[model samples]
Target chain A: MIKTYLGIDVGSISTKGVLITENREIIAHAYLRTQGQPIEAIKNLIKELFKDNKNIEIKGVGTTGSARRLAGVIVGADVIKNEIITHAVAATYFYPETRTIIEIGGQDSKIILLKDSVPVDFAMNTVCAAGTGSFLEHQAIRLGIPIEEFGDYALRAKKAATIAGRCTVFAESDMIHKTQLGIPIEEIIRGLCEAIVRNYLGTVAKGKDIQPLILFQGGVAANIGVKTAFERALGIEVIVPQHFLIMGAIGAAFIAQDYTQKTKSTKFIGENLLDINFKTKTFECRDCTNFCEVIETYKNTQIIDRYGDRCGKWSEKLPNII
Target chain B: MKVAFPYLGYDTIALKKFVELLGAESCLGPPLTARTLSLGTKYSPELICLPFKITLGNFIEALEAGADTLLMAAGARKCRFGYYHYLQENILKKIDNRHCFYAISQYTPYEFFFKKMPQIFGVTPQKVIYATWLLLHYSALIDYFRKLIRLTRAYNFYDAQKKELEALRIIENVSSFKEVQKAKKELRKIFSPIINTSNEIIRIGLVGEIYLMLEPFANYEIEKELGKLGVLVVSKRSLYRHLKHLLKLDLFDLRTISNAYKYLKDSPGGEAIKTVGEAHIFAKKNIDGIIHIYPFTCMPENIAYEALQKLARDYEIPILSISIDEHTSKTGLLTRLEAFVEVVKRKKFKG
Candidate 1:
């Protein structure tokens, strides 16, 4: 049987899965919208990733993203990490000289500065959603342009119209105002792209040294418009990796490979997790005045996992908490 | 009379002992929770710093717990913290007028420890002096307790947490000055087993506003979180140090100011100068990284944030400044912290 590692990233907006060979090669990959249902999304993505390979034995599993804990529990992952570390691992692995990484996900934008393949510093956009995938998706819908074609229209612009991008509310109003001014729709779209790049650099990437060999990953990298804007603004080439959308999955796989090789064991429950009925429920714990909202993940009838309780009264119970 | 003051996480024990020795029953506001924060937020002016809101909530809870005298530390000319007690008293009077509101001026060490406390507690100045002495010693004990907890937790968290609970019990039961020393010994004994097999541990310096530094709830138990991530947090800001600073007996003051002069020419009020100074010290000591946390929109800390960037560049150390508000989500904070730990560890391993 061929040895392989499984990596899953369950984000707020999307869920991604990837299978890698012992030599760190992509064997299979899948991406699907989470749509507020992470469990189902992971299961569906799992089915798609593992369906094409039958002889491969999963040696280890890893999970990352906002829903990393839930994904870890679901897959019995050997390695669970935040997106920042995972993203950096993948970027530096692909581009060893990568000095900076620009990652714009569904609701957050992050700028990670690396020196000699190690992350030196980083920053995430705080309390702002002005320059993320969701914002771009919203503007695309408002302009009656499919997000897939949004970049091509941006490419069509001869001269981009100026649009405010400091705040989402302001950006929306400015976009509407530009539409009323009869500026070409393509120019308006291009302007929106530049505005996003401008805001991202000003806020998330502020004061961060943007050197050569920068890689832009996450969901927003699919937009060539933003990529082009970044290149023009920074006067540096931005490389979008072959598996840019699934770079986090790739990184998780690398981490899992490192962990399982050290421990010589795999906790991965297998890719047939679809047969299990998984559900999660949250209840307010009134044990103390804190009133922490305790969450429990159930496998069929038995409660398999619990969290969110600060005092760990519910979470510390091992195996079957109930 | 039952006395109450704002809670300062585990440091509450020392505060309680200080009040009790002064001949008044101590009633600290119930451990900070969402309910207290919400109650405090309801009456506070929009855009006020988080410390103000949380302390107001503590006072409300204290009054509800039958505390007859509310003692709040007051100061303002250097920072907005001075006006906190004034505003809090005005708001608390509307909620309950039966309790007396006393804004203890913090800068006046002699007046506060000898005159004010003696007058309030109907005790001799000599008794008040002893209580003040105990307060300093007890605060230092807790400060040492925090360090032990961080070191032990970073060494091995699974066994270290239970020892922490037992250690807190030991710290709380110390009533005499000698017992404070005994408690410290017991704490080291409780943690020594777990910390025995300790290996390479990454160290991060935590320096920011004094209130944020001392209060675990205010900073969301950041020291504990970093310790759990296998990072030994070297945070020097403590209530013991603050008291020393207030009394003009702090020996570390000269170095902090000289360091501040490297990045800043003058103080911008509050602990902004101190923040830069501490970050400078942490950098020179070769800390893996530095985490700076203060309330969002805090003027003094914001100035410190700028000086910190230049310091980070000069020292080539990663400094993360987190501006916290009521809306700061726990999940977001964890993600930032976890990523930061990875960054620092990676940097250290490379070197």
Candidate 2:
């Protein structure tokens, strides 16, 4: 009887899932576009993960990423952790000696500092969208190139063009200006990678203590040119783990395994939970003048979890989800 | 007048030393009790820092306790601390406590206190020298204590050093810089043997408007309080810092200077650059946390806030944002401060 653990990462742009066996082998994994429907995406993820592993008994379930709460409610996730914790845990579990983590996703960029397999500090770029994968994707479409070929084109460049990468506004204008100057496409692509790396250095990693033994994970890790740019900028090699894109899901599974082993009870609502109805609503709280925007999760008529209240006034009314 | 001075910058010793020098008795509010927070919260509107609420609560308590004058420090430039005296005066008037608010002007209406020779215990020069000496001692003590707290690995050992330093507040004879220096040296010597002086604890740079940083009543005195929880704070005299910023604004072109560059985009003041430079320095130092404070509706700080967040991300340090205004409450501010401190501590210990 191969014992398995389920992990789900429900993010704004994508929902990812992974099923791991007792030996920490990824038995099943699935990636699906969330399309602004986390509930549906998670249901689809669970459906795909359970497609082949009919005999595999799930010991526990974990959820991570931005929409962890919503995923938790939908998937009956036993462990709900933040992306920073989940990513660091996964990186450390695999590499063991990972020090810095450079995670650039479609919508966000994060720099996680770790010492001895534990997260020391982390910085996430939520306000600025300039150095993220979506920014590169937008630029790639504008440059008449597929996003996948971006890395190869960048590597082929003999000389780099200077692209203003401070903000999207500045970058667009500067990119157009550089194009007007008749820079080669390869040079421009290389310049884009450099600009991203430079922007990341100037913003996300500004005051952070970025030591060596860095791990680059996320959708953007597939880009060799960006990886090269990071290596050049930091003068250090970045290790991209085998399961870089699904590391969050893997980390969640690992956590689930660890947690369920101790609790000895499967809190998972089971795969049949896909049929449950759920909705998320956000409202501004007028309590105490902070006006905290509280996000509420409802299962039909019953409220499952309410968060985003900075003072924990509204969250206090809900169950201890943490 | 049996004046009551809410401890803002520095610590109990700084207030004690000042009270001792003034030859005037002070109605010392209890050690930032929960009651103090409630008072602020009850009276304060939302959206202001916790420190402001607590201070107002302390003021209300002091007035009820028969204290007439509330000694405070004022500033100038874009930092909202400059308007503290003016705003507080109005708030108090509306509350109708009728207590005379005698602020020790650090900048705004700077001439009103120094040049006009405001009376203190019927002695002008004596008050001036006394205030100056106390300020110097407080500045030195804060710098040393924050460093000490950060460097020490053993929590007990750090507490021991703090206890020794705090014990000096009861002494009423720090009338000169010589006395202040003596007190500081003795305290440092007591801490030298105990604190892990070798370990450089993560030094955080708190760059923003001054009011929310210095006035515990405004930002919940988070810096010093964080020190109690083993996080060392680095902050200069709020008034002095803002004054230098004002001089730079007058001297440099509003558009060219980096310190006030943010202000240049909207207005022509050098305060924005001053804030940016400070944020840059903090980032460059690779400080563990950069807790930025700003007053609500403060345009210059808002500009700096945008730039600082970017810097925080780039520097890889934890940054906490705090906005203070007339409506801010003490409890709300304290909760944020607690969370911020907890995050920093968790990160430090885990790392």
Candidate 3:
């Protein structure tokens, strides 16, 4: 039987999963909108992956992204990691000489500086979505353009107009003002792309050394316009990996592979778990002033996992099952 | 007289005990909560630093709780903290005419011990001297336990938390100097089992504004968050060390102040000088990184932050400077901490 590893990255805006072989070849993958229901997204993702490969034996499983803890419990993952570590591992795996990794996802963006294939420094945007993928998507919709064609519009611009990128609200207003002055849509799009790159470099990557072999990955990397903006700003070619959208998931899978090889066993429940009825309910625990929102997961009306409590009052009770 | 003071993390208990020992009924305001912050912000000047607002709220709450006498620590430095007591007293007087306010100047330890405390509480100088000694020992015990908690929580989260609660209970119950010594021995026993001596643990130094460094609520319990991330935290600012410096008994403070000379030629008021000095010390000690936290709109720590940035660049160590306000979210702070820990760990691995 061929051994395979599974990785799931359940983010706020999207859920991504990948299935890989022993030789790190991705056999099947799925990307779906989370839409506030991560359990359903993971179920559909696993079903889609299973449909592509029949004879593969699941060796190990891992989960990453914002909802990694919830996804880890649902999938019984062997390794649960954060997005920063997973992204760094995945970036280094593909591009061994990658010195800096710039990841702009749906709600957040981060810059990870690496030395000798090891991450030496990193910074994440704090409570700001000024230059993230979601911001670009919003601008594309406002311009009545599909997000997929955003890059093409930028590429067609004769000269990129300068827009204030310090604040999201300011940038949006500036874009509207430029449009009112009869600026071309392509130039406006190019300006927005450049604004994003400028915001990212000034805010997230500030004061950090940016060396050669820079890799850009995340959901936003599909936009070649932003890639070109980054290249133009840094005066160095920016390489976007083949699995840009699913690099976090792929990195999680690699982590699972490493973990299971040492432990010699897999904690994955089974491929047949797609049929299980999983439901999540949340309630505010007012035991203290923190008022932590506790989330409980039930499988067929039986409590399987409980989490999200700052104090492990409810979660610690069912340690046997989790 | 029923005396009250603002809560400064678990150090409030030590202060409470000191006041009680001085023959005054120590009525501490309710442990600082969101309600306290809201009450503070509602009445305080909007532009003032967070410590002023929160402590003002604490005084108001204590006054409402029928405590007639309020003791506020007065900052005599060039920072705005020097005026916090004057403003807080004026505000509290408007709420109640019968309330008594005492501002203990930090610069004049002799006046605080020999004259001001005696005049306010009607205690003899001999008794005041003994009480001050006991207060010093109590604060030291609390500081020592805080260090132990920071270290133990990194390796064993649940056990460390349990032990911390137990230690706090023991410290709070101590009524005399001998009891303080007993509590210290008991804390060592409680913390020893959970302490793991792993060389792989990342060590981070914490510096910045005194109140934010000492009060977990002000900085959203950053030390606890770092501890949970398996990082050994060494925080230099504490009431005990402040007392030691005031009494001219602290050798380390002298070293830290001198170390600041490399970055800052002289003190920038408040704890900024110490902040820069400690960052230099941590860099020299080969600590992995430094976490600098201060209240929003704080001037002194802001100066320290600029100097820290230069030090970080020169020392080749990462520094995470977090400016906290009432609006700072726990999830956001945790994410920054997690990312910083990952960066430090990776850097350590490369070495």
Each prediction's RMSD over C-alphas, in Å, is 2.3, 11.2, 2.9
Best first by lDDT, ranked: 1, 3, 2
Error of 1 at A262 (Å): 2.7
* Better DockQ candidate (1, 2): 1
lDDT of 2 by residue, B1-351 (tens): 677777655454556556656677788655454566677678775655444566777787777777777776665445555666676677877776657786666444445435533465554765755575455556555556545544442343335544644534522345566765676676676566676546535455676665456665456555554654556566443533333343343332332245434323343232555566656665566566777777665667677767766665556566766666554554445434544554465577773
Model 2 segments beyond 4 Å from truth? A207-209, A286-290, A310-313, B1-104, B107-210, B213-351
Off by over 4 Å in 3: A320-322, B43-48, B76-78, B86-98, B124-129, B194-200, B349-351
| Candidate 3 colliding pairs | none
Query: Largest DockQ belongs to which candidate?
Result: 1
Q: Compute the DockQ of candidate 3.
A: 0.36
Cα lDDT tens digits for candidate 2, A1-322:
6789999988767788999998999989998888888888888888898888899888999998777877887667789877777788889988988989999887778787776676655666633678687788888899888988999999999878988888988888888888888888888888989999999988777656678889999888888889988998899888888888899989899989989999997778886777778888999877554456788888877888887765456876777675
Could you arrange the candidates by TM-score from highest to lowest?
Answer: 1, 3, 2
Candidate 1, CAPRI quality class derived from DockQ: medium
In model 1, how large is the Cα lDDT of residue B236? 74
In CAPRI terms, where does candidate 2 land? incorrect
Q: Model-by-model lDDT, in order?
A: 0.88, 0.70, 0.87
